[model samples]
Target: MSTTQTQMRREIEEIPTAVDRLLSTSAGAIETAISKIGNDVPFLMSVARGSSDHACAFLKYACELELGLPMASVGPSVASIYGAKLRVPNAVCISVSQSGKSPDIVELTRAITEGGATSVAITNDATSPLANTATATLPICAGPELSVAATKTFVTSLVAGLWLLAEFKQDQELVKAIRALPEHLEKAIACDWTVAANAITGQSVLTLGRGPSFAISNEAALKFKETCQIHAESYSSAEVMHGPVSIVERGFPVIGFAASDAAEDSLIEVADALTEKGALAFVTSKKAKKAICLPHQRTDHWLTDPISTIVSFYTMVEKVSTARNINPDAPRHLNKVTETV
Candidate 1:
């Protein structure tokens, strides 16, 4: 069967439209939350797990870079397991979940809301317990994702969180780029990284990114395991050489995701170095010398570029899974919504 016939592939294809829906319908709620948080919030805290947590990581970078505010990921166990209340006054707490029904997520969001932090929920369900507990909600509007693995919802959550940060920072250029993302994503979905896919002969691979793209790398690594049954690990371009590069052997596959940002050159340099070591490295930048260059769609803002790259990677991974005779829609021992305490 063609990869396009799979539920995962269909959901991956819906990412552009899903993001467009979120951009159009979520502005009012996002604006309202921005007004509630005001301009003087000191710091931000994020609570999430799995793919949603990866989206939070992406937003953490965006918030720290664009708004100049410190951001940290808070463990949900502080509230759910330890029952300790945090004293985060004048801070915004962002919770992300595709399914807003996760017990730990709901409990932590409630705890933070009661502990003097402005709570914001980015979720697909508007009436979930998390939504009811938060001070404001930014529904992802990804619609019903039927696949066990999350594709459209994950991308939409990233868009919603970034949109909130852009509105908060009053970055008009970034906001404009975000509004134009659906078109860029459409172009990204058409990008073919078949050369990179064909190079994955090893059972294990490394995915590298820097700054905001680091979070994208995390999501890519997770998807590689979930949909393609590949043992993939993600690392920051800066940190990989410190410890992780020791494992790279000749012909080992590596995929580096780099955007048009200050860190782009540095990341590409790492990819080139790996390739020079006889590893089969693929990078999404034209600056690569020894590493194979993968086709990528660039957007106006650096933050949005990773989103497009991920959409392209999703397309490529779906094909890879089907080629291996594995169903991307239904992986081994996985489910759609995992609720944990």
Candidate 2:
């Protein structure tokens, strides 16, 4: 096996404890970062790209419900060298990155700090440019991920970001709930992925969701495309119906993630539509994929996504990769890290 594959396997097994240790050691930092935010901060605005950007979507939902704070994702243009530019102030601005070296992420941290927003960063890289620039930092502590596709780092970011919400609000209940994440992930790691992969083998897969689950769908597809080299796609449920729905066929495996959040009802409507098209859509609930019929848990989109996403993603990636005799950790034309414009 390749070194990349070995690292991914290790992370799949080791990350549950890393999360626990990070929480225990960084409780103080989490508390300090939250104390710096003011009530005048209308909402939390986050800056990121790729997987980190998707994570920001979930964090956005958590801040609104868990902290009673409205949230938005910064256009990320202002952070990037090329794109439209806008900035938010009196709001807590967060940048999530694994390497903390993405040009856009680094610039976002600098822009917000200069613009007088309370700049914070969550990253796995300790001495990264972003870590030095942020007013406060949350080290995700996912350890060294030598694979191009993010696995444990993304999960840890969700954990670290959720803890940030609880710390800011001193939300004991939510904090307590987060401690169970390690166990939840263990169940996720052990899931049977072969069947799902076989369901859509050699065909394009569509990962669909609404609200926070929309972001989860993106991350799920990211893993499939990046690791398994499959032609997987992700779309917002409403948007999919608009034009992308034409791509779906009976042979296609459609993975649906509906979170316990504001857009749950809309997602349900979409799932029913998928059935009408004769596509086998599998929906994931908090407790496995069992309660697709139950109402969503909370309006916190961020809180619910990782619960459902991590599991479904693990299964889908495994299924596709094993069927092709490919190791997900080692993909053609990709290394563990990249520096691209």
Candidate 3:
């Protein structure tokens, strides 16, 4: 059975188009939020959970690097579970969700707005409760994702957040690269990572990345478990050397996601070190000496490179899941939309 037969596969293939749609249609909302956020905001806060939180993790890195604005993840439980009103004055709160209907997310967005923070919602559904509560809403325009495991929506959310950052920072380089991502993503979706897929021997696997790619590693690890039922863990290349490297045995699988950033050399070094230890390590960088180098699509900007890498990874994992006799569309004990308060 080919992966193209599954709904997850179809959604994965639609990522580039979904991103293009988001970029074309969301300019007004993104520009409006950027205009409102001006240069004087003291801090930024992100509200989300699950895959949406991973998008926040990527944005946290991008905002700090590009805009020099520090970002912190605000726990939804601060308002939903604890009923504590946060005093975040002159702060911009960005919330990411696919459905935009999660109770805790909506409640927290409301609380943030009430507490004097400018609220922004990045969601697929523009009419959801979260959108209604936020001061500004940027819809991802990913269309309907029928698969229980999110693919197009996750990528579109990342694009929406990054595009907003680009507009806010007024970085023409990043903005140009962001506009060119659809072409790069098409190349990414065509990348062949079957060698890395075959390297998975069913034992525990470790995925490594640094900076924005670290968030992609986290999402990849989750998708491995969600679709293939594979036991996978994500660690920062810097953090993996601290303790996680001890668990790596001969023939263990390790995938290193390296984008064209300053941390690429560091990630390649760790991947090579794992290969030296006899692990079947694969890295996306061409500079790896010992680890097998997997092919990846690189964009004009480092921040946008991870987007392509993840699209390639989505293709490989869908194949891995189907090879393992698992249905990629519907994983066990999972739903298309998870609502938590």
Candidate 4:
């Protein structure tokens, strides 16, 4: 599959299959390209723009939880926009780009390397400008994605991110768990979006969480806005309380990821808080969303929830779009490969 492929049919597929690809590729390179950076870097960081940026957010969260490595995403314009600088002298900069040629990302990679950090490009093109500068590269097998709204590539990137974390940490339990993704993906394809549609179809939706869960909410909101053309946004439960409180109103579909774990109490509190404000909350557990749940994803380690949840919502969006007879293969205002800086 080339980078421009998008399938229109409604079909069920297991997420584990994608995770398996991630684990195999990352682990297979553990002794070589993938893990070699440990020699020069004591920490990890990532940079991207748009969907690729979101992927790096997930990567930062996963690497922190799985490997205890401190990480950050250098905003695309940190150097260009604010003249702010990345100070890591021995860090790994993982740049994610579908085309591997975004000028901003390439510039950022150059900045990181000049600062004495090693960079690994996780992209769809090995020869892209971004890849051309990478010390190493990890290409996703999502084929050619044709839709302007990203789907498979986003989900695949999440898989690859976690798989890479497993490689650096050599967390066999987590690797074994990722191996089950294909099966989970198969089951995820079977998810029904009727309820999600009913709640969000014509309304503005707000997804709220904290830490990694907050990132998941961001991705969920992004998918909703992209595929369904709806108004959706995310808030950290904490941040929302600070100022976003005024926007809370009746009839808003506020999806709260109240998974069981360290953030469970706070997440549930946020759900309660939302319910108190007259919003609806749909919570899924690792076991509740079993097919896509990876290992070591206990309540304390709920960062993995988004990995499964993205696969879940991506399937639902496809379902809802098709039910509305909206061709998910192509949305109204987008194309297969974007050429943004």
Off by over 4 Å in 3: 1-4
Q: What TM-score quantifies how close candidate 1 is to the native fold? A: 0.98
Q: In candidate 1, which residue pairs get closer than 3 Å at backbone N, Cα or C atoms, i.e. clash?
A: none
Backbone collisions counted per model:
0, 2, 0, 22
What would the TM-scores of all predictions be?
Answer: 0.98, 0.86, 0.98, 0.83
| Candidate 3 lDDT trough over 10 residues, lowest sum | 1-10
Model 3, range 292-334, lDDT digits (tens) per residue? 9999999999999998999999999999999888898989999
Q: State the displacement of the C-alpha of residue 5, model 3, in Å, after optimal TM-score superposition.
A: 0.9
Name the runs in model 2 displaced over 4 angstroms.
1-6, 75-87, 260-266, 285-305
> Which residue pairs come into collision in candidate 3?
none
lDDT tens digits, residue span 86-170, model 2? 4566778888988988776777678777777888889998789889988888898877887566777887888888888776777
The better-scoring model by lDDT among 2 and 3 is: 3
* lDDT by residue for model 1 (1-341), tens: 55358998888889999999999888899988988895578899999999999999999999999988989999998898999988888789999998899999999999888888999999999999999999999999999998888999999999999999998878999999999999999999999999988988667999999999999999999999998899999999999999999999998999999999999999999999998888899999999988999999999999899999999999999888888888988899998888999
TM-score of 4: 0.83
Superposed by TM-score, candidate 4 places the C-alpha of residue 303 at a distance from the truth, in angstroms, of 4.3
